[model samples]
Each structure stands twice: as C-alpha cells, then as structure tokens.
Target: MLRYYGVDLLDLHRGTLSARRVLVLIRHLPRDSALVRALHGEEADWGAVEHLLAAVVDHLAIGNWLFTSAHGDSEPPRPEPVPRPGDAREEETAATPSPRELAAFFGGL
Candidate 1:
C-alpha cells in the first residue's frame, strides 16, 4: 500500500479516484490558478488528475518539489549568511525602489 502525501497510490493505480477524493487532496495543495479552478469543479478529467498525481510523486522522489512556488516561480529562496564577529565587509540592506522605478522596470518588459 503506497501513499503519497497521505493519498493512497492504490486509488490512483486502480483508476478509482473520485471527485470528492480529488477535492480533498487538492485542498491540501498550495493555492494556484489551476488549483483554484479545480476547487470550483471547473476541470473534470480523471486521467489528467492521475497524471498530475504521478508527476508530483516523481518530483517528490527527486527532492525538488518545493523548489518551485505555487505560482511556478523557479527562483529558489536564498538563505542569509550569518556575519562573523570580526568580518571586514558590512552587509548591505536591499533598498526599496520608488514607484517610478517599479513602473520603469515593468514597462521595459
């Protein structure tokens, strides 16, 4: 009896996954556009759902599941380095840009 994130792999393998069961599993997942649609019962393909579960399982096996955010941002979070007692370099804080700078940045794209 294999289980991935508390969902029984037997249900997937047996092709007996129900909408209610899918709803329960999806609710525990991170909030995103596709998930929002699923929550509203907009998408209803059992095979696609099964494929999604398989993909998640594969990702988990590779230990890169949390590397991407719900919004699909590939940039991983960086940990801040701890300064030593006698460090010569000072840590520079990130400055908040003005609205004009923000507009210009997005406008360039």
Candidate 2:
C-alpha cells in the first residue's frame, strides 16, 4: 500500500520512516473501498486491509517509536490518569488535588 502511494516500503521498513512518520503517511490513505481494491488488486480482502490500516493508525496514536533513528530523541509523554465514573464529584472538588498537582506543590518544599 505504501508503494501504491509512491512511498518506498523499504524506506519505512528500514526505520527511515519512523512509526510516528508512518502515521502521518497513513492519514493520507484513500478511504474508499474501490480505491483500496484498485491499489491492492483483486486479492485485497477489504476486511483485512481495513484491519491492518486500523492497526497502523492505532500504533501511531499510541506514539510508537520504532521508526525513530538511533540519534532521534523523544520525550516520554506525561500520562493522564483515567477518571472513573464513581470519582466524578471528587474529581471536580476544589478541595481534593490530583496526584500531579499535589506532587508539584510539595516538591517545591
């Protein structure tokens, strides 16, 4: 599929196109079924193609660094905790501070 887009699959495979880069490239993929078939030929299983495409997109969303060069530097993204429905009110309360905020406040001391 990368070849169909005139992108060298070898380059991507060689890590020249980082996982982050593949995601940017995949966003440009043609979404129509007919176009997909045309590119992959008659053997293209729409479901499988869709699944692989989705997997690539998912990896990109997760910020995989597989494509990065040995010299490339990426700061780890700060994670945000998922809020539980049961803690909704506590989450909103000004009296309660999040772990991050509390850490920041005490760390200065």
Candidate 3:
C-alpha cells in the first residue's frame, strides 16, 4: 500500500504564486519505477498538484481493501497519533476515511 510521506510547497518569494514547486512522496515505489514518469512535474500549477495529491491519498486508503483477505483481517491497523511540534502533550488523530467516502472516491475515478 502507498503511504503518505509528506509534501513540500516552495517558491522564490513567500506567499507569492510565481515559479512555485511542489514535491510529493508516497512510499513503496522502487527508485526506477515507471510510476515516477506520471508523477514528476516540471511547471505544474498548485491547484493541479493539490488535486493529484488528494486523489492519490484517497486511492491508497481505499485500495488497501483489495489485500484484506491476504492480511486475514477485516479492519486495517489503527494509525498512531502524530505528535505536534513544540508541544509534547499535543497529538493529532489520523483517522481513516469511511467506507462510503472511499466508495465515492473510487467511483469518481
């Protein structure tokens, strides 16, 4: 399954839209995988990049169902809490999307 690594949005000037670069990483692909050809960007706009990332995240979450039998589990493992920076006590829940949402997301694709 694909995992969310992180995204970095960079530009020459802060808060400016000119010459921005968006780099995204989703784990599990080999270094020489042809999938990189589709994901690599040269001068793509922010909106398109954001949409692609969203679609990818949704796809991975839903695609896990295909391997449920092999895993011998009906439910996926619960995600661990992500600690917030500068606040040791603060944590964020990483909830998996509902089945209905996954259905809709895949249907649209």
Candidate 4:
C-alpha cells in the first residue's frame, strides 16, 4: 500500500497508519494515481514490475474485492493483474494491521 496508498503495512502493524493524515492518504487514492498508471499505463518493464510487484498486484485485487464486498458497491472495472510464472504463492500479509489502531482511524474524523 505504500506506492498507491502511501501508508506501508509496517505503519499499520505499528498502529500508526490510522492517524488522520495517513488514513487520508489511504482513502484518497485517486484514479490517476501512480499505481494505476503502472497497472494500466504503458509501463516499460513488464518483466521487472511483474516479478517485483506480483504480490502487490494480487493484494490490490484482494483489497478491492474486500472493499467492494463490504460496501456492496460496484467500482469501475479494471484490468486484472498479469499472471506471473509459477505464481509465487508464499505467505503474505505477515503484519496484519491492528484492529485497535484502526479503530482510531475513524475517530479523528
């Protein structure tokens, strides 16, 4: 979530990302954001970006799915991430965000 959302998982794990500014960053990812550009724009390094960000792309998909399901809102269709060779399915999400910290995310509002 760093590139697009500007809040790293580490911050979330540390119970920091829910701060008002950070939550604003995460919730306000614009359509023309850099992550969207890399995903849909004429990216030059399919090989490198795919290898480096394959997991990130998957997480984006999952996050989008979760958001849509939770809110019951249909977002605009976006292209699926390119499948990686062998599809490294190692354990991701090592540092799940603290629910208690997230509780404060909305409190600042």
List TM-score per model, in order. 0.20, 0.25, 0.24, 0.27
| Of candidates 3 and 1, the better by TM-score | 3
Worst 10 residues of 3 by lDDT: 1-10
What is candidate 1's local distance difference test score? 0.54
Ranked by lDDT, top first: 4, 2, 1, 3
Clashing pairs in 3: none
Better of 3 and 4 by TM-score: 4
**By summed lDDT, which 10 consecutive residues of candidate 4 come out lowest?**
85-94
Per-model CA lDDT versus the true structure: 0.54, 0.58, 0.46, 0.62
- Model 2 misplaced regions, further than 4 Å: 33-109
lDDT for model 2: 0.58
Clashes of 1: 0
Error of 2 at 62 (Å): 47
Model 4 lDDT per residue over 1-109, tens place: 6666555777766986667766567456654667645655544234565666877877788788777767875654554665654434333444555777677876843
The best candidate by lDDT is 4
lDDT of 1 by residue, 1-109 (tens): 1233566756865888776777777656543345544564423233355657766666574455354544465755543333333334553434667788898999954
Clashing pairs in 1: none
Give the lowest summed-lDDT range of ten residues in model 1.
78-87
The C-alpha RMSD in Å for every predicted model, in order, reads: 19.0, 21.0, 18.1, 20.9
lDDT of 3 by residue, 20-81 (tens): 23222334443344554356532222345556776676667556654674586567664333
